[model samples]
Target: MTTRPGRGRPKASDGADRRTALVDAARRLFAERGFAATSVRAVAREAGVDAALVSHYFGDKQGLLVATMALPVDPAARIREVLDGGRDGLGERLVRTFTETWDPHEDVIAALLRTAMTGDPEQAPALQLARAVLVVGVREQLQGPDADGRAALVAAQVVGLAVTRYVARLPHVRDLTPGDLARVYGPAVQALVDGN
Candidate 1:
């Protein structure tokens, strides 16, 4: 016997609808409570969907953040790309990759940096996320007793460069082309990486 379709809910549309709802809820929560404060359960509750769906859709909170922020580049992937080859010129590669990734998205990067630096309770999570990306990426490539300190130094250098060049629009830093910046800044970052 053939079964007829019943008009109750559309099965095919449920996935798309739920995905949309999840993204919308995540966007709202991330903006309101910041990345670290907004939990998967909270986003799910706001979307009226199961918390598991958030994982299914975004893999994790970081993934959700990338989506919510509409970031032009994926930090983890870019970090891996920069660190892919041997550790010979990691600093240069990292600096070059960072500038290339952020150049086109200066406005977005500026907004994120502002939010992270504001010291607002709601925005603290944003700062943490930034720290995690930079520190963790550098730490993974380093080997020694002072890995953490070195990682922090690397993070500072990168963040300082971003703030001065992109956000603050410093005359000298702002004027350098990507290659010039990489050539000038790469050794500084390399020193940090080498813990020298």
Candidate 2:
């Protein structure tokens, strides 16, 4: 008799399916309960999987959130496009590019912002997911061994501007024209990227 390949114990097809179900359920719940209030146990119940499975699939809530919101774009490729375009005046370009890309679709970002502000543990997934994608994408662009810190700082500035201008809708800042924004916000973002 012949046996199919087995790395260890039998692999379950349901693992992937279950993870998808959990993420979908978590997304809806996070939207509804505002993240902090939602629990892995609750998500597992909703997904019809044992609570252990949630841990097994996600390693924890943050992992699940990161996986769930996995950027709608191929972040690594896009960041490469930006960095490879030459670094001069990249601040304005990045601000313009990111805002333009994220602005057209307000619903998704708004939902994420709302959940995050509520300070729910559930929202950790979305916040961390966004951060993880950015850090991973921009890491390759840094120079020297301390590149990680520079990359992180840049990511923070990029994300902060996004949140302030778009998510929080800070009044005066929000009303500024694109040209105005490039003048005011560009330097800050640039400093982060320039690491000085």
Candidate 3:
């Protein structure tokens, strides 16, 4: 009686699928319970995997949260698109860029922000991931004789806009039409990038 190579455990072919399942489960649970309340063991249970598997795959709860919150869109590609035009037009470009990219239905960027405020260890990983990915990207474009200060300024403004528009849902702020946003807020963003 010949048997397949694998014995007790399922084949590694399913590992990728299982990891994906784990991340999905973790995202749902994290959103429902908040990062502090969710446990790795619970995530594993939800994913129908061994608890150790969760650790093995994600390292810890924080790792799992970061993995779970990853954006489907490629951030580098998005950043490149936003920064493509004349550097002087960067503020308008950034506002338009985020308005287009941060579709509530397309990616859970806002949801991640909501959880990030909790300051939980689990949440920290994801927050750090976002800060590193976003700040560094902006910093990269800004790091130069003329752009260094502008980049930092622009990054701060972008963060503030995201908080006001999405996380806080400030009605007046959020209600601004894209065109109006460009007209009103564009200067602020430009100031950030322009070192004004």
Candidate topping TM-score: 1
TM-score for all models, in order of appearance: 0.61, 0.53, 0.60
Off by over 4 Å in 1: 1-68, 119-127
At residue 174, candidate 2 shows an lDDT of 72
Better of 1 and 2 by lDDT: 1
Q: Which is the leading candidate under lDDT? A: 1
RMSD values, in order shown: 9.2, 10.3, 7.1
**Colliding pairs, model 3:** none
lDDT of 1 by residue, 103-175 (tens): 9877556657755664454544645765777788778889877998998888889888999977788999988
- After superposition, the stretches of candidate 3 with alpha carbons farther than 4 Å from their true spots are 1-33, 38-67, 105-107, 115-147
What candidate 2 gets wrong by more than 4 Å, as runs, is: 1-77, 116-130, 144-146
Please provide, for model 2 over 1-196, each residue's C-alpha lDDT reduced to its tens digit, 9 standing for 90 to 100: 2232434443664244667878888877765565667898898888776777777888988777666555465444555566666667777777766666666544355557665676555644656665676676566655666678877887778767767776678897678767777777888877766767
What is the C-alpha RMSD, rounded to one decimal, of candidate 2? 10.3
Each prediction's whole-model lDDT (CA): 0.75, 0.68, 0.70
Where is model 1 poorest over a 10-residue stretch in terms of lDDT? Answer: 1-10
What lDDT tens digits, residue by residue, belong to model 3 across residues 1-196?
Answer: 2222343666665444778878888877776677778888888888777778788888887778778778776655667777667567777877877776775432256657667777554645645655566566666656346565566666677778877886577897788866678778998876666555
